[model samples]
Target: MNEKQFDKIKNGKGFIAALDQSGGSTPKALAAYGVQEDAYANEDEMFNLVHDMRTRIITSPAFDSKYILGAILFEQTMDREIEGMYTADYLAEKKEIVPFLKVDKGLAEEANGVQLMKPITNLDELLKRANERHIFGTKMRSVIKEPNEEGIRAIVDQQFEVGKQIIAAGLIPIIEPEVDINSSGKKECEQLLKKEILKHLDQLQDTENVMLKLTIPTEANVYKELIDHPRVVRVVALSGGYSTVIANEKLKENEGLIASFSRALSQDLNANQTDEEFNDTLEKAVQSIYEASI
Candidate 1:
């Protein structure tokens, strides 16, 4: 990634508001919002629900303007016009919040008992779209479901390879190697993922800067070493499935690491709330995550 572009996102309050939920994720969110069971029956319906959720989120006072530096958006909603303006355009125009796209097609079939993201096809074309939309970066996911070093290595290899391509197209890449927090041997998986990440990162040219979005490791300050690496623009932690309270607690101990949380950020929000309650709820979530970043 270009250091200049990376700097804008890495500095300040380095919190990413991840609103890029896929079809599978939408149903769960709808259930939490107490949407009727019929709402989850069709893909189109799911997108509509997700779109409405995005409307509430983007319009909320806490989003795109508070301690957030950027947002990672689902493809369908990235340039989507809400009211009379595009979501990305609205954020940039009003809040100075950067926008990023989620590019990978989701997980592939498990390899050696671990899951990796499917490569993005026509990625150059997608980057062209992102550039056109004024999005500054991209995020893709791969999960370490098991503690196999070889498997994690494969995942990181693919991430770095795709990441280089993203940089070539002038967008920053947030390489996510998420470890399943509830799985057996979580700490071991974290160690394996970290080691494999270093393998790809150490081999990159000095001019290429990459950002990491890893699951929170069991040990606090475990990622400080990565932050010190010159090639790494910033090291960010995902909340995974942790409650906001627990996520914030773990995040506070890790100096130099910021949050890129999705669920934890929205866990308390619901369509049932009044505007005042919704804004207050979102503000508290933002404040907690923001304080952890500092």
Candidate 2:
């Protein structure tokens, strides 16, 4: 590991504060939009879009100033070996940017009052892949499913095991526990989510060099509560489902320090927006945060 580089990441509160205001929304959303059932038909177009989006982001003021922007890679999007190679190459070229690998296959569905567990059972394969990613000059992050106490415990155990493997291989691990809000009211959900997060972090003590990627609660106070946790070292807010613009605005409002935005920029790319337009919007957004902090 580059101690100097790692130190830069560890000491970057202002940079993270800027990133919290903008980064993750573009990649996750774009992956969701581009990798639909028939998306493979337009592989070239999708790859180009990803390439353009990456370039635009890295050139933004945030990247230049050393903000830690994280991105997650979904299996659906990189199912092919060549696709995975491309992603690794792209990420390796931009080693300063944090690139996360999404391991949970998908959301577990509730059936007849019973929630199913969506575990990435192939631990060796996942770790092997993450190791390959490290060789290419970037670290990895994974997402754990939100389930009942038993399920959550299982998820935490699995993640700790994975974290150990990641550290042995010299990679950073991000433990992302996604809070489900579909069935519960927003305020109630946020409170419960906070409790769950605290519980998970406590269990994660044995894991070294770990960060938390949490979903921003719908309630403002709930967001504040989670952000205020003394044990919380780093917080990367999710862009949530489909609403990238709204997500970006909300992240900024909540003082979230990092974002993995994908959807909003994908829309702009699909609409054939010019590079200038995309760059201008990102610059303005980042500038707003920078100026506000000053």
Candidate 3:
């Protein structure tokens, strides 16, 4: 990763807006906004709704580097033209929001007590395109339904393995090992997850350059070591299913973790608002999340 590009984001607003919902999640999001299931009955309609939402986000007068340093975008949204401007370029040049690409192929069938993200077979091509487009970074994710030792270990190993490739490809990778909030033994699992992450970081001689996006642990500030690690550039938290208000409360307590929220950031936004109402609503959401980062 280019140090200048990385510093531009890390030293500014301490949060990243996760707008990288896959095709499967987009319709549900649209439905939640009262677009109705029928309105996005097919792929094209669903994509159109997402495009409009993304455009509104970038064009909002409230959009600035102060509230959001970066945004993680799905492949379609990354390539789509935002009012004839390349979506990523418009965000970087016009709004100062660094664009990060989502490279994981969602989840694969469960194995060894966990769900793993499918490998990106076209990663080299994807990275080339990202570099060509001047995008800043990349993100990939895996889910932990339960904290089985074997499962968590496999996940940590896989993330760092891919993370190394992303770094060599000239983009930072936000490796996410999202633990389910409702899982039993969540607290114990959190500690185990932390240990495994450290184990992996130790293996990487150049980890000080790595980035992490983990679920908020049951205990506050439990990731102090990882956050303070010389190899880790930034540590961010995922809201998972929490509401924005609750997510902010948890985020405020963690010294190293900044918000990289998806649903919590967009859940309260309805499609019925006027442009002024929408921007005001967005400003409040962005500001609350940004304050927690501070």
Candidate with top TM-score is 3
- Residue 211 lDDT, candidate 3, scale 0-100: 79
Q: How high is the CA lDDT of each candidate model?
A: 0.83, 0.47, 0.85
Return the candidate ranking by TM-score, descending: 3, 1, 2
Tens digits of per-residue lDDT for model 1, 163-197: 99988887889899888888788888887777777
Q: Please say which candidate is ahead in TM-score: 2 or 3.
A: 3
Regions more than 4 Å wrong, model 3: none
TM-score of each: 0.94, 0.63, 0.96
Q: Could you tell me the lDDT of residue 144 within candidate 2?
A: 31
Off by over 4 Å in 1: 1-5
Best by lDDT: 3
Consecutive 10-residue window with the lowest summed lDDT within model 1: 1-10
TM-score of 2: 0.63
Candidate 3 lDDT? 0.85
Per-residue lDDT tens digits for candidate 3, residues 206-279, read 54367789888889999999989877878889998999999999899888689999888888778898988888
